[model samples]
Target: MSRFVRQSYYRHVYGQPSKREMCFDNIKVSASAWDTNLAAANPKFLSVNYQASGGGAFLVVPLTHTGKLPDLYPLCRAHTAPVLDTSFSPFSDTLIASSGEDGKIVLTHIDEDRLTAALRLEKPEVNDLEPVLRLSGHVRKAGHVKWHPVAENVLASTSLEVKIWDVEKAACVVELPQQPDMVGSMSFNWTGTLLATTCKDKKLRIYDLRSGELTSMADSHTGIKGSRVEWMGRLDRICTTGFSKFSDRQVFVWNSGDISKGPIKQLTIDTSSGTLMPFWSDNDILFLAGKGDGNVRYYEYEADELHYLTEYKSSEPQRGMCWLPRRALNTQDCEIARAYKVTNNLVEPISFIVPRKSDSFQADIYPPALSGKPALSSSDFFAGKTAEPILVSLDNLSETAAPPIKSSLYASTPVVPGSGAVSPALPPSEPPAPRSISRAPSPVSTKHDPLPSSSPAIEQPPVSHQPPPSSIVAPSVDAHPEQRSSSSSADVDQLTKENQELKDELAEKDCVIRNLELQLEKFKTNQMKIIELSKNSLN
Candidate 1:
């Protein structure tokens, strides 16, 4: 008999879909043919691509405002064409960016107070929300917009080329080399140093943002449909979702260290016509929500293999889907992640929870999550400073502490702490190395340090017309020559520590390989027994 042991704490996690009255109804989701997620959400608001007659617009609803929406509600109408994609800033609840067919990106600031008041009215008056800033540079229709995970007020928009913008200064800081074809999706690594993009060319490209250089490009899924790429945090890998040559949905895991060699592992999901949108709940759990499908399948990535977890199925098909930030998760209910599914006229919230009897905080399931606070300013990041994300404790984050949504719509209200409430601190050990890119001959050099314990209080300049520097340079050393000896000794000690860490990782991998071999042997023994039994029965 084959004896298999399951050893994951999150293996029992299941999804709980919100009821009809709890979900936002009467939403006019966009009918655009663009293969993009039309919805984006944070702790405070949910922005959905709105279907309108003229010009592009998206509805920004307060999280608290649930149930049937008013017929004539306000919308963020800043684009003259149909909007393709929208992304909420990781560092701010009120700030969001939207890209449209107008070849422009609009940065909108949600007036929570004003929007809440309008939603409360029996006969809501018509009001058009305006954007705070507009970025116009892409000559073609911008299909996607993503905010930097670890930087404040920094956004990336994809058209013919990828443009990195400083939202505060209204400037394009870095424009990556143009893609061979239309970009389907883009994902930034943990430290915001490398960018992974999937294009219509059926290829994946990783860009080294520091030098504005193309790191590695590899053939991805071969199907004609769109593909999406996501950087798996801390794992030093990239997971891409697309279709196989036979049009079967497939997931590929590629080594970030060297993507040119191709994906390390590939698996075929069922033949679903809809594109699979991949989202990482944490570093381990991956949620795959297929557009036009009602089921969302999740998997746990471990030992270089994606272990199948469980699937959440619903009868209502989703046109688009978006995930809520980790900081906004309801820890009291053992909720691991939350995804908002956009149906025809409704936006539903699906909470992935781990069933637990205790009311205490589950620290094993909830590690330190990446806080909304940025690791470094845009200026400091561009100046060659590499830092890990500032992590925060989820222990104090309770359902009662969630952001107050004032609408009469639902039962339990969730709250998000203000940005100022975040503690700027780094973990004890150095986090995984920031994804570094390499050219043919020389590899990209990156200095890894746990992020600063405290955020710098420097303010960014209003205007920045200069293009991004060609290369990132380290900070200047002190002129005092007497400190050289001490610096050399410190470097030696750090190198020794890193070497030991590498050795420990290698040993752990070896142990995993042995365990897998033993399991394979047991499976073979079980197969033999079944074959012998069948032969005896035939005789």
Candidate 2:
């Protein structure tokens, strides 16, 4: 019976397994542009657009679960042009802001049950919800629209120029003039104390929010320049990227203290034929750079150095990147979640795991004894009858097995004078013996045997060793005047050489200017002759 029971247990432990199941499904939707922008209201809610089979565009999926994106419920559909940017208000999860090429900015709320009911009931007749506000002041296509970080009712719109709107009053609060060309991007500092604007003119302008004054500016990349600027949340810095004329795409970190100064640090990559889109995380330590090459790169910022963390790839080019506010450290499972616009009409949101914790198999493992635990316990040896007894034998044991004496190497010892004790030795017996001296050989006579004395005797030198006064005076008289004149002459020669070079350069410039002047004069003479001939013909 026992053997049968053991066999049954083995069978139960090694039984055939059931097929695995997936938690989420791959959601497909139609977008207008090759890529669509994705925004999440919360961990459980996300929003995306879908191309209507009939025509135009619509905000189809209002709030879909992060785990699974079900069929979209058509909520709002009023724009004729493709939506360029969409953003959820940071202050309220229910409210969202969207701007399209139609130059309209619509603010709407997501009805929770209406969305779920429409999906459950398979109702295709979801109503067009009324927008809380419709902003309509942009002259050209509205490129981007963003809600103010600290202001609940303030929104910013960017096109050729930047305009701030007071939503409650439905009035433009301020109009920022464009710098000669179009404005590519704009962002407000974390505290909403400063505003940063990037232009197609290859310049970044910073404005003081309180005073509404232009504070500073920096030169940006000259080609494929960055259309976005993000101020580091907790740092006095800003990050931007664009393609350079040098055929290299670069991202720069500029210091807020001195904007006129060049970039504090920069990262360059050969995109070959792609573009780079960068986004800043909540804490700013992690920066997400998405390339058109279908790869997203993660970088850790330490001071001015950007350390490469890892890279994730997608089959399609990523159009937008955002860091969702994770609920907790454990819940923050991914570094960055991206949205890829695969086709001109389809957008797929993909999230890759950042893997904050390493896999156990790759880490070092230790035996039970070495795994941070006590090897043995005193109770094991002193337990009752249930414990095994330890045997003691006298036959082979050493009689004088002095309770294993520990070496004094690690033990402390007291000092004993004159015995080279543990303590440092006393100062040497006396001041070190004085060094001995040696006598010089005489010039007039041969050297004689030197005495082996303990110390050398002191003596004074003869006066004949000193130089005569007349010899010294004669040398000074011969050299002083010539030395002074030569020093002056060398200085004159250096000045002459510098002056000659300047004169030669000036002469060449003059020659070129004369040739230009002569050409101008001849052209003027021919123009006068033509004017005189025309006058004669008219008369």
Candidate 3:
């Protein structure tokens, strides 16, 4: 019989299990801009709209490894009006495009290092970064700009009308005339063969890019005007949102295969006061919707379940939010997620940290006699001798054995099963016949002593088996010698250098302070002497 030591029981209770934890960091950008837009290059770099002062500016900040933001790069400074929308080129990492209220769309290639140094310098020192191409054709503010997903040089801008431009040729490729109201949002399918636009007239229209013809048009929201339209990840599905005060603010997911038909899934929002800002993830498995109530809700498409995973509250209403893509960081592929908010005078962007499991540790050893114990099998360990022992019978073993039952060993009295039950026992069955009895021999007869029985009779034992206690050794916690030596040596050297530098600085300050004190004392002495001379002259 094997016995478990008390130390093992305590180890099971106090040991730290593997856990997943997450932390969040925020970055503030562009001072006091009410109308702003944001975009990112795989979360490593971000571009935000600085829509104050005369025209507006674009601030590009680097997401540092320590979760802090470095200085911003001011890109695309030629617009004479507030930038309405900005987007990073999906085809190229270095390219960025922006549209302004000045009715112009500008494309620029950013030099990240030079921009970072310029923003760190003092004000009035302007950087020479300029846009590569600037197109001006729209009569009103270009409310939205989107890059063609498949084509490299193809771009689209929407305002009063939707216009497609070939950036390399510096000319408009095609133009689609709009209805009475302005076009609010525009997006292209993954293949760039189809384009979808949402108009203020509460209509969602899809166009065939090859022929430049109106393929299909559907009335998305009856009472509310359409605000945005997004093509759900390479699929034939598209999502659109509406903006209205009295009407219900809702999102409609439609199948692009037949655009004239109504939406398949209509997600409704509370018509209180908040606006729904929807962002689709790359996998299309999840999409996040932010509301004016300051909650970020996540919805899975397949399960049709909306999980309120996380939320951040703001005193002011939310403006907009978007997700960054996955990229390589220090040779490892990682996804960096971020959300941008424009609330009151603050422009804040929040990022999330992915939780990871703890590092591996040494495994505990068990004795050979008890090596067949099951690890983490509470039923096998807790059940008494009455219960079947399948694990021990099968000889299954693991490094960390399950905890044994201690109550059975320490309890003085055992509780019998079905003990205090009422009623009487059933009638006993008939007994079996007795075997034939052998004749007893005369006492002290030396001739033939009856041979002693070969097998001895053993009585049944109790359920609890108390085994001897074994010495329990705790795991070592000391650091390795190499690690300790290197840490101490580095710390000593750093402290010595820092101490010398501090002493030099302090000595210099002390000299300056002593000089000032000496000057004050001399001035006081001169004043006292003059007072004495004046008194003598007066006498």
Candidate 4:
């Protein structure tokens, strides 16, 4: 009754699930994603952390489906700390990158030839795994790694700093450093040009390669443990998950057009203890989020708001989880989304299928269909050239059916004319809104009629601390120092006004800080009350 298996799978990722009857049979593994930084699954293989007593191993298990690992056990071992995260390259079926406590980024090549041979031997087998390339740069544990969704030979990692690497050249091309705050999570926009990151300092920062570092930032969260970001496909909007001033888990939607204005949409997910990991489906129309628990909630993205669809419940709580690529899903079964959930000692597959009998192809999850080829240049990478990424549309819905948000960045055309390299998008409509935060002129413009019908020019995002792109000439302080006389009267007035504004800002911040401290104390008191109640019941 359940159909799910196709494509060449090179690895086995740990997942947990429960089904009606005979839908899925899970396999157990000694090495799991428990208390580890990562577990990932793509079309061909799976990567998970495998820790031994003396050292640590990053296992690349073949998804042989025989319910057993081939003779090649525990793939490879070489990390000083429990492996933090692993990512399979979107461009190559054989390449995977792993990072961890040792501050090492290892690119390992999977021996597909040997794996194919082992399958014919009548018993499962694994070949000796080794790193094909190693690049080290992070001073602290590299907590996460993500390959550019539409680019080849490119990867990004986060720890105390965010580094964009060109695997072909084995060099870090751009690095965004953070002090006094560690990055909790990072997600790239549909075009792979911008990255949204949530940090321990309770702020969300968006970084762009063209602009050297930290292009945008906003104060966010309060629990101070973890926060995460997910870019809504193709649109200029981004969704983030973090804590409130009282430590309650909340998810917020931001208009990157002017991040300083604050979140445009916010929701309180739950009071659960585990951090919430949110995933936006390739279709760009649905969102699924799972917390530290077994329940996974799905939502419909419509009219700039998230509408709850349903929740997937598992018998056991998952330690970690991952979603498979859209191309690899059983489209025939109306399967909209699939997740590999890692639990106690097993990884199971769970499918979110829609009920239908006509067997019609679902075009709503359709934008990812365009990313069939590698978009990055290997020669440019080897030459130490920081090439701009080729942007592709990942919008699964048609503009006629679903439209772009009121204040969203509207782009439906391709980056290269005749190439059809568009980021899936809903066509533009209406004018832009006044900035949510007042400061520099908004970098993205709405004044220009949507991108030309033929030529595609994606202006790079400006790097923080650097002069913004030359296109938007920002007014200089001395441009009109004195409109009245040669005395610079306007300049002196401007300074006096600026000083007053600064005083006002400081006073406002002080008041906000006092309010947050009070809330923290209040939460602590409630926690104490709950503890006392538990103690009395024990007595």
lDDT score of residue 516 within candidate 4 = 67
lDDT of each: 0.76, 0.49, 0.51, 0.59
Q: Write the per-residue lDDT of candidate 2 for residues 1-539, one digit (tens) a residue.
A: 45553211012111111111211233333454422234333433455554443322445343243234334333455455766667766545666767667676766666666566655664233334334445666777676777665445557877777766554444455666656665767777744546898887889899754345688987877785444577765456788877788767777888766779888787786655455666665322344445455666666555466656556555656444444433211223322233333323333444433444543321111101101111112111111101111111122221221121122211223121121112222232221132222321111111212223332221111111223353233233444687766865776676667666765674465445434644775698899999999999999
RMSD values for the candidates in order, in angstroms, are: 23.6, 37.2, 34.4, 21.9
What TM value does model 2 have? 0.56
Off by over 4 Å in 3: 1-43, 65-75, 119-124, 243-246, 303-317, 328-337, 344-539
Question: What global local distance difference test value does model 4 have?
Answer: 0.59
Worst 10 residues of 2 by lDDT: 363-372
Clashes of each: 5, 2, 0, 24
> Which runs in model 2 stand beyond 4 Å of their true positions?
1-41, 52-72, 327-539
Q: Which stretches of model 1 miss by more than 4 angstroms? A: 397-539
Pick out the ten consecutive residues of candidate 3 with the lowest summed lDDT. 9-18
TM-score winner: 1
**Model 1 agreement with the true structure over 56-160: per-residue lDDT tens digits:** 889999998899987667788788899999998777777788999989888777777768877888855554565655677788999999988876767799998
The true-versus-predicted C-alpha distance at residue 534 of model 3, in Å, is: 55
| Candidate 4: clashing residue pairs, number | 24
Ranking by TM-score: 1, 4, 2, 3
User: How much is the lDDT of residue 92 in candidate 1?
Assistant: 73
Candidate 1 structure lDDT: 0.76
Displacement of residue 460 (Cα, Å) in model 4 is: 34
lDDT of candidate 4 over 17-94, digit per residue (tens): 444232212322334332233568777777666543344566665654435443334255546566777887776667
